[model samples]
Target: MRVTPPFAPVTDHDLAVLAEQLGRPARGVIGIAARCVCGNPTVVATAPRLADGSPFPTFYYLTHPAATAAMSRLEATHVMAELADELAADPELQAGHLRAHHAYLADRARYGDVPEIAGISAGGMPTRVKCLHALAGHALAGGPGVNPIGDAALARGDWSPQRCACARPGPMLDAAGVAE
Candidate 1:
C-alpha cells in the first residue's frame, strides 16, 4: 500500500463519529486523514468515486465542525479572494499550489482511479482559491508543506488543531450521535 494521509485505520466508532460530524452518514470515507488533539477525526480521506459509483472529486474532507466553521468564516470575509491575489502575484506561491495539486492527485491515486476526476484537485488547486475548507483539509491531512493554500488558510484561521475542540464521544456526541 502506498503511504498516504498518515493512515488512520477506520472503525465503527470512527464511522459513527464522522456521521455526526457531517450531520448525516459519512459516505465514501476510506480512512481518517487528520485528527483533533482529543483523537477525533478532523479530516477524512474519501474515495475518488463513491460506492454509488458517482465521481467524487474531493479526497481530503474536513469534518470538524469548528474547523469547517472557521474556514467558512474566512471565506465569508473574502480570504479566498485575497489568497487568490497572492497566488497570482507570487511565483513561489503559484509553484507551491501546483506541487500541492500534484501531491493531492498522487495521494488519491493510491486509493483508486476515477477517470471523471482526472487531473482535478480540490480547493481550486494549481490556479484558484475557491474553497478554504478543501485547502485546510488537504493541509491537515498532508501536514504543513503538502498544501500551501491549506497551510496558509490554517495559519490565518482562528481554529487550531493543536487544541482539543472535539465534542468528545460520550453524552456530548459520539459517532452514533448518541451517548453510549
Candidate 2:
C-alpha cells in the first residue's frame, strides 16, 4: 500500500516544541501528523525504526498533553475493555478495524520495512483496543474515517482539536512553557 503525504516536514522549531511536549527530544520523526487549532503538534509520524536501531511500531504518536491526559482518563475508566468488546461484537466495526490495521501498516511501511516489527500495528489494532492514545493519534493524523476505534475514542474524549489547548501559540517556547 502507498501512503500519501498528509504531513509537513519536521523543522528545528517543531523539534523544540516536540521536546517540550514529549519531555525528550523527538526521535525518528517523519513529520507533524496533526496539529492543534493553534498549530501545536497533536500527532507526529515516526519512522518504523528509531535512532537507537530499535524496532518502533507506532506510526502515529499522540503528544498533546491535554489529549494524552484525556485518553488516559478514558483508559482509567476501562473504556479500552468496552471498545474491545464492541470490536468483537460488531461485525462492521471489526472489519473496519481490520482495514485500519492494514492502513496503519501501509502508512508505516512508507517510512521503512523493519523485519522485527513487521505485521504489527500499534494499539492492538485489528484485534483489540489497547491504547486510546495511539488510536486517537492515528484518528487525528489520518482524519475521520480511517480508524473506527480511533474515531470512537476521539468522539468520546473530552478534548477537542478544534480548540487550542496548547502551551504556547507561535514560535518555540522556553522551558517554563511560555513563549520565548
Candidate 2 lDDT tens digits, 1-180: 325345666778778889999999888999888877666788999989999999999999999999999999999999899999999999999998988899899988878899999899989987989999999998888888888999998889899988888887645435433345
Candidate 1, residue 123: lDDT: 89
Error of 1 at 149 (Å): 1.0
- In candidate 1, position 22 carries an lDDT of 91
Clashing pairs in 2: none
Highest TM-score: which candidate? 2
- Please give, for residues 1-180, the per-residue lDDT of candidate 1 as tens digits: 123654756878788989889989999989988877666789999988998999988999999999999999999999999999999999999999999899999999889889889999898987999899999999998888888889999999999988877777323334443333
Relative to the true structure, how large is the alpha-carbon lDDT of every model? 0.86, 0.86
The Cα error of candidate 2 at residue 174, in Å, is 25
Off by over 4 Å in 1: 1-6, 169-180
